[model samples]
Target: MDTILFYTPGTCALAAIVTLEWLGQPYRLCRVQKAERQSEPFLRINPRGQVPAMLVDGRPLLESNAILAHLVDRRPELALLPRHGTWERDIANQWLAYLASAFHAAFWPMLMPQRYTLENDCQATVRQAGEEAVRRELRRVDTYLEGKDFIQGTRPSALDAYLHAMSRWGNSLVDMAKDHPNLWRHQKTMARDPAVRFGTAVERGEPPPEPHALVGHVELASITL
Candidate 1:
């Protein structure tokens, strides 16, 4: 498959990138500079100007959760998800929806409080509200992982990668290490993964190490839309 992932560093795109690395499939990366994400070039790829968009065989796939689910469907042998039509599958879908919707929305005011309010003085309060929301959600996730190593149990799935990515933002907003031990453990363990490391290194503008499946990194100046 001709696959190319368009991402901005530190976004949820990291999860999909890590999953692709684990699949060991030949692919390429397109790093969209944050300042230029909403510009014409990226807007052409995803009208919403979102990160975590991809071109699979020249077809566009947008949204992080959709990308993760597609990866599972593409490589079912990995068993990253449970079987279809079962309660397990429904529960898994529920988690994905929650992460993408409520969990992710909670970070907006914290990350971009200006969007939430018109008054400059109100931004701080808006941000605080977002932090409170994030903390509450983090506690919920911690409780969910109380007895399991990952969201779906012991075997590492794409879900863990998703959690790891979102939790990176969550960790920055709160003292995850001190307050949410279970989430902290999950984050640290996933960070040790070579695939996760590769995604992180690339996000930092480093070339992936030798003998990797990554075709190469592309900048807007270097490639056509």
Candidate 2:
């Protein structure tokens, strides 16, 4: 399979990278810069111009959850997800939906208050609301993780990768390792995986051109296809 993942550093796209690493697939990585993401060429690739866009055999796929699902679907033996129609699969979907919708939504106002309100005076209030929502959600998730080594029982699944990438976002709001012990424990466990480590380092600006890496910047004007 000819695969290429477009990503911005420190984004949820890291979850896709982690999935790819775990799949042990040979896929290319294309670093998408902020300015280039809005360009015409990138927009052609994904109208939304979002990161975590994967081109499978040059066919584009958007959304982090969808992309991760596609990867797992390709290799069911990897068991990143439970078998279809099972209660475990249903629970996994529930968690993924919550992360994609509620958990991710809580960070927008805190990170980009201007997008939520026009009144400069109310930006702080909006941001504070976002922080509280995030904290509450994190607490709930931590409670759910009370005795689990991984989000889905003991085995590391795609949910674990998503949490690994997303829990990092909370570190800016609280001492993740201290305030969110369970979540931090999950993060720490994923960190030990060689795939997670490599993906994290590269996303944090480590040297790339590793296996399956197609070294190139996302440039609109210069795009060949």
For every model shown, what is its TM-score relative to the native structure? 0.95, 0.91
lDDT of 2 at 6: 88
lDDT per residue (tens digit) for residues 1-225 in model 1: 888999888899999988998888899889887887888887888888889999888788998889989888877777788777889889889988998999889889899999989999999999999999999999999888887788996777888888888888986777888899999988998988888888899899887665567987777655555
The regions of model 2 sitting more than 4 angstroms off are: 208-225
- Tell how far residue 219 is off in model 1, in angstroms: 2.7
For candidate 1, list the clashing residue pairs, or say none. none
lDDT of 2 at 72: 91
Model 2 TM-score, 2 decimals: 0.91
Alpha-carbon RMSD, each predicted model: 1.5, 2.2
Candidate 2 at residue 178, lDDT? 84
Q: Worst lDDT window (10 residues) for model 1?
A: 216-225
Per-candidate Cα lDDT values, in order, are 0.86, 0.83
